[model samples]
Target: MSLGMACALASACCFGIASVLQAVAARAVEAGSASGVDPVLLLRVLRQWRYAAGLALDALGFLLQVTALRSLPLYAVGASLAASLAVTAVVASWLLEARLSTAEWAAVATMCAGLAMIVPASGAQGQHPGPAALRWSLLGLALVVLLIGALAGRFADRPRALLLGLGAGAGLGVVEVAIRLVESLTSSWRGV
Candidate 1:
């Protein structure tokens, strides 16, 4: 597998688990709250603890992403973070005692299949920087992702948590693309 693909898969796996952990922590906080209190107020209090934990995780994730970006291309890193939704779904269900609908399960399976299909077989040629086609493709895909995530964010029950996951994914995607462009420019400069 190409370095880019490996980086993306790594991002996906790590970010997925992080999302789930965040969900689990949130559910635990909610469950531990007492009755007859304003949820917003309780949540503000809870943020003290949850945000601290989240910040630590976020720092670790950022470091990993930076290390990955130094070696991988843009698309790989972005796609890996896509697995965050699946991670979130599983984690939320377990922590909140929520049931997963068949549709959600199907979505998770489909995502995995799609990732598998994009990944090259063993010993396949490493990905070359393509023409404008690949760049436009990535741009178009990013736009579509943003639109879908916006729609989902609109109706999300835990909007705060959900938005964090979406934002993190989007941010990671953009960072990867930027890193790839920077790497290309530096490479061309050295060649000149």
Candidate 2:
């Protein structure tokens, strides 16, 4: 649990820093040169050093997240990941020279307090081999999400952005749950 907590916090920090770096890179691009949905903009952003560094950080965060998921309950890891928003807020304030109102600071504090409450109540990862039906359901959901995301690609900028963001979040959530399911299946197999 302690190790999981450490990994979770590290993951949050990496993700937070990466977000700011990516934002800096994005902001450097020429405004109005391309639409928000333009794939060329991704290529442009990838050429920036900050963007590369952000990608490296994101990779590290992903590894840390996997480690945390293996050792901690989904809820606990989820809470830690959610706290990354607070970390991003702070990083943006410092690095981007963005100002945070008093209310924003209070919200950050509230997020921290909520995380503190969650950690103590979270127990170790469960050993149960979740039903095969659950794994199939997850697989089905992933396929459906992929279809929706593909359809969303045909929309205008704002709607596409919203749908893509929603799809990404759902995909990540599914990955988290799938990790646990995989672990359970593997452990069960080894015992057979």
Candidate 3:
């Protein structure tokens, strides 16, 4: 694979792990609350320091994602981001001092397999898209993914989040593939 593709795949792996961490962190915050407490209320309950720390972690994740995008294709970046689930799992295990159950591992495995299928398998077509098209397409796909994820939020839980996040990730992967294909076709026609 080319450096760009490798970066994208690495980013996807990082993203998967990060997602898992976020899940673990979220559950911790939820579990820390008193009985019958609404999760929405958890933020208010968190002291300023706690909130800041959480926000910092989120910022860190964003930074890593952006960095990865610089070296990878859009689809690669998206797939890596979907990988946030794997990240969440690892972080949860370490922070909570627990191991993922067999069922949870199985679910994560399935998600990773799906991600592999979505990411581009070839590196020969290392075409770069124009800034405008890349921006608009990514924005559109992101909006759609978030919209779908939000719609799924009503059914919030680890499993639901994992599935929804993967759905969003797949959307991103498809966009990248489309972009690469278009770039190849346009470039070929120009050559002709």
Candidate 4:
């Protein structure tokens, strides 16, 4: 396999393993009286060795993902990242002894098959530097997310959780494009 593919797979593996570690750590720590999204609970989880290892793996995964992005197209990288779900399922099955349904196994197979097709067919990364406006728009989105997060407490528990999830998803999407755009911008500035 190519270096990009290797990096992508390694990144996925790191993320998958990290997921299990973090989940285990989260469960190990008992929560306090706060019924909502408790910062203290998060802090407690942070103290766990498993969580620390998970965080380290997450950082490593991100770096490997960036390396993969430098060589592979965004879609290909995305598909490869999706492979993390498959890895997570497998890892969870093994470590957590979580029983997988036949459908779930089938889904994993389908995902793996799709990845097999994607990695081999993917071309080198495209050179287009995205529009300048994207940067400002992303900033705007981030500010909006922050506003939503600040106002989240106003809503009921379910709504607050939903709002936070939406905000997080949007924030992650922003990161997705921003990382590539930043890379493009840097490469352009370097005249590479």
Best by TM-score: 2
Q: Which ten residues in a row have the lowest lDDT in candidate 2?
A: 30-39
True-structure lDDT of candidate 1: 0.61
Question: What is the alpha-carbon lDDT of model 4 when measured against the actual structure?
Answer: 0.87
lDDT of 3 at 93: 75
**Stretches > 4 Å off in candidate 4:** 34-36, 183-192
Cα displacement (Å) at residue 89, model 4 = 1.4
What does each candidate score in C-alpha RMSD? 7.4, 2.5, 8.0, 2.6
Better of 2 and 3 by TM-score: 2
- How well is each residue in 1-192 modelled by candidate 2, as lDDT tens digits? 488988998999999999999999998985545454456888889999999999999999999998899889999999999888999999999999999999999999999999888888998677887899999999998997798799998998789889999899999889999988876456689999
Give the distance in Å from residue 57's predicted Cα in candidate 1 to where it truly belongs.
Answer: 2.8
Q: Candidate 1 lDDT, tens digit per residue, 16-112?
A: 5566655555555544435423447546544755545655665666666666566654454455557666766776677556799999999989888
Error of 2 at 92 (Å): 0.4
Q: Write the per-residue lDDT of candidate 4 for residues 95-141, one digit (tens) a residue.
A: 78899999999999999999989977997776787888988898899
Candidate 3 lDDT by residue in tens digits, 2-101:
5554555555554545444444445556453454347665564354454445555566655555555555555556665666667567566776676899
Candidates 2 and 4, the one with greater TM-score: 2
Candidates 2 and 3 compared by lDDT, better number: 2
**RMSD in Å for model 2:** 2.5
